[model samples]
Target chain A: MNKSLNIDAQTVSVEANKTVEANNTVQAEKRLPGDLAMWFFILAELTVFAVLFIGFAVSEQLNVEMFVQGKAKLHQISGLINTLTLITSSFFVALALTQMHQGNGKQAAKLLVVAKLVACIYISVKIWEYLSLFEQGIDIETNTFFTLYFMITFFHLMHILLGMVILFFVAIKAAKNEYNASNISGFESGASYWHMVDLLWIILFPLIYVI
Target chain B: MQSTNANKKNTLSWLWLLILTVISTYIGSFLELFNTQKSLFIIIVLFIVFLKGQQIIDIFMELKKAPKLWRRLLFAYVILLPVIIGLIYLL
Candidate 1:
């Protein structure tokens, strides 16, 4: 009888352990998905944009007329179009990450290509806008507004180019199935950088063209 | 099946982001360009920006499940900067 009770207790303990393990898996703790270094880089990039944005705003306050006048010269439709393109491209990047997570690297590669194409529209529109401004005698020395406008938008455009290069590199690797369900840190890190670029533009749009 | 559901949710969030962008553009034009309702423009536009920024941070950046410190730091920047800019414009 003592032997029987010992076996029964051992069976109960084993069952309890299994249940605990199952629960632990089902309720896995949340974690950030990419490189910690990438997160720090994003933070640094955001801080730079924040400082520039604040400077632009404070300058706006000091010279409302110049800012308003400069903003008027800018094409609101171009701003709107660029905003739409960036956001759409960002959506595709997110979708690509999802595909990567599902072990569909080919699809993710295709999605990244699509995203880059969309971002190309933004590049085209912005360049045309700059050319038009130049035709109208607008330059960095045009006024405080144009000076900041040229400075800030030009800085942001460089970021978009850098992001495109990063995404391109990731997409090429993803096409070879380098990233999968178990290995996606590099892809996630690149995607995070792309998102950061989009985030900066979201704020820049209204700050420069609208209000 | 779970991945499909996640994709669906992301597409829905993308739709929301598009809607917010459209709304902000329309409002900005109506108020700032037309020079009508100027007083309310900054608040409304900045609020929309906050929503858009929050969505990108959560859904796109995938920072929603991150540690509280990182998520909160980004959130603070999105909110605080606009508040400061809006205050400067308003006052």
Candidate 2:
């Protein structure tokens, strides 16, 4: 009987170890919130922005007076408004992800719609700011400062547009209950991209408009 | 249950972000009006940008729960650029 008991104890220890290993696997899988591909894209996009920002800084150093004057001509209040709008949109996107995780796909879709609407407002404000600048004869080729400003902001605007397209598809899928807690990679990927847009704006707003 | 907890945490993070943005705007305006301590104000603004970027990465992007390498990459992106910008301005 003692021999049988020893064998049983060994079997239980092995089973326990197996269980622990399985749990670790699950935890490891859970650590990455979204698609690996999206993270790669984010890294690449950030690198481009970093390069552009460095170039802007170098150009600013060369023509501090022009940069300062160009900056003064910018509508600071409008930039501030756009900053707030993007932040609000990002907040909604986060909420949409949360709702998706909770298996509330319809709510998630609605939240994404709100995010898109706010993004539209941002685009509108940006256009208005650009138009006002044009009225003041501040086109892209006017100076180095204007060139950099137009390039960076317009490039960022293109990202926002692309993000909107991604959000459109994600929202449609989410509305159809395509994403749930167990399967939300697409939703997370789209949200991640949108947040990158906001993150870049958060940095850009200060770098160009305020500082 | 987990979703609810995550939602609360995200909402709190968003609130913190909004507050920081408001404070930064106020500081920006103040710097514009006063025009003294320009370097200090710029540093403060960049620091706020860094903090906001960190919050977005950690909370919204959910990188806080990610692997060490992923988190480090993002943290480096957020911190390094601003530090470089600050150094450029200061020097």
Cα interface RMSD of each candidate: 1.0, 1.6
Residue A186, candidate 2: how far off, in angstroms?
A: 0.8
lDDT tens digits, residue span A64-147, model 1: 888878888999999999999999999999999999989999999999999999999999999999999999999999888998
State the TM-score for model 2: 0.91
User: Which segments of candidate 1 are over 4 A away from where they belong?
Assistant: A1-29, B32-36
Per-model CA lDDT versus the true structure: 0.90, 0.91
RMSD for each model, in Å, please?
3.1, 2.6
Tens digit per residue, CA lDDT, model 2, A1-211: 9999999999999999999999898677558677999989989999999999988988898899999899989998899889989988998999998899889999999999999999999999999999999999879999999999999999999999999999999999999998877799999999999999999999898888877
Q: What's the i-RMS for candidate 1 in angstroms?
A: 1.0
- For each prediction in turn, the share of the native Cα contacts (below 8 Å between chains A and B) that it retains comes to 0.71, 0.61
lDDT of 1 by residue, B1-91 (tens): 8678778867987899889888888888887566656869779999988999999989888888777788899999899989988988888
DockQ of 2: 0.65
RMSD of 2: 2.6
Q: Which ten residues in a row have the lowest lDDT in candidate 2 chain A?
A: A25-34
Candidate 2 local lDDT, residue B16: 88
